[model samples]
Target: MTRALLSAALLLLLLPGAPAQVSSQTSFTIVVSNSVTNAGNKTFSTFVSFRGILLGGMRRLQDKDSGFTFKYTEDDNYGPFLESVNGLAGCPNHRTYWELKVKKPDNKVILPDVGIGCYIPSAGDVVILNFNKY
Candidate 1:
């Protein structure tokens, strides 16, 4: 091969765009439950872009899963506050609200300090929407 051709090939190999990798979406599950009682329990399968936020996956679930539905309000201080799931709204008067939890592939559960808008889910993660008091 010509010297110029070889140099061009090496440059192509060094270029970031020359070896484009497809970013596949990640699959995970969301489990909705009533922590105060056994009123509602359901699971939904959904996906999000690699590095996407949890709220994006929840929106995708609502679009694709008929059994899953949720509502949120923008909190100037907290971003997105989960208000309800499956037609059940949290009432401040009753001290009931939705809590965000996550179960990793290793079966360890974590309570994220941030709401859905800020939380990002990993592959095989099980996000729990727990309806609880306080």
Candidate 2:
């Protein structure tokens, strides 16, 4: 009976139904810039829980920094679409939109294929919200 119990315990340990691993929170930075107007960039510090989306960190930053604010619209197909930041709204008529980019700690910059609601930021990543005309 003891051997059977041990086998059962070992099976449970090797099972795929085990709880998912949890990770600690990670810190990153966010930079807001306007290439269309040449406005200076505003940098803010924020953190995200393990595997948390960028929108969560942005919401946290907005809550902590009075100077930081943002708004988004929910799309039935594409999830949340960023609409405005710091009173500057992206105008479709003007061909202006907020571009999402990320700079890693090693200085490699990349444009994520996903939007803010889906992108999972890593530690020391610099997320850039650039306003530009496309």
Candidate 3:
């Protein structure tokens, strides 16, 4: 009876539905830059939970680093839209906005179709928030 129970337990553990150990958090870097003003790039390290969105990591960074700050507004159709970084707000009259770009571990830069509220950043990703004009 003991042997049978052990075999059943092992089978259960090996099943596809069984939960496996996984890391709860992922670390990445964030680079803040200003194209219009030519301000030097500031790099920050932050982490988020597994499969967490980029906004979560940004929030975590803001809480930890006094040099980093951000603001966003909710859009009815698009979700959260990044409004400002480091007290620099984008103005429609000035045709300026904050652009989001991500550099992967392989050094490939990608402009995510989704906003920060949706983009799930991978480990080792370099997320760039650039101040630019449209």
Candidate 4:
């Protein structure tokens, strides 16, 4: 298991009196399209890292969970980013990284996942990463 190996690596480092180092998080060039359904109405442009972070863990949006935000959240030059895992069997409904909704002065962005709000992204709508693919 990847986790097991990581644990072992950490243990090995500790055993040798070496400092445990967190792996540098991965990077993404996430692009949100208008899905054609929105059809030229939504914004579809490439936004680089504007100080972002990935999120995951027990901080999942699940009722069955231990009510924890067990996810990995990262920050970079762009916006916050989070990787999500569904709460199915071993998968906890948690985000693996942080995906931020880039701030806007007067814009509305709708996340299909929760359908919670009609957000307005003025600074080129940074996606509030709720999408997951495992």
lDDT of 4 by residue, 1-134 (tens): 99999999998778747555655432322232222123222222232223322222112223333422223334454333333333211224542222233323244544433211222222344444333323
| Candidate 3 runs further than 4 Å off | 1-23
For model 4, the stretches where C-alpha displacement exceeds 4 angstroms are 1-68, 85-109, 112-134
lDDT of 3 by residue, 1-134 (tens): 99999999999889789456567899999999999999999999999889989999999999999999999999999999999999999999999999999999999999999999999999999999999999
Query: Comparing candidate 1 with candidate 4, which one achieves the higher lDDT?
Result: 1
| Residue-level error in angstroms, candidate 2, position 76 | 1.0
**What is candidate 2's TM-score against the reference?**
0.87
Against the reference, the lDDT scores of all candidates come to 0.90, 0.96, 0.96, 0.33
Better of 1 and 3 by TM-score: 3
lDDT of 1 by residue, 58-133 (tens): 9988988878899999988879889999998999899999989999999999998888998878899999999999
TM per candidate comes to: 0.81, 0.87, 0.83, 0.20
As a whole number from 0 to 100, the lDDT of residue 127 in candidate 4 is 46
lDDT of 3 at 22: 67
lDDT of 3: 0.96
Which pairs clash in model 1? none
Clashes of each: 0, 0, 0, 57
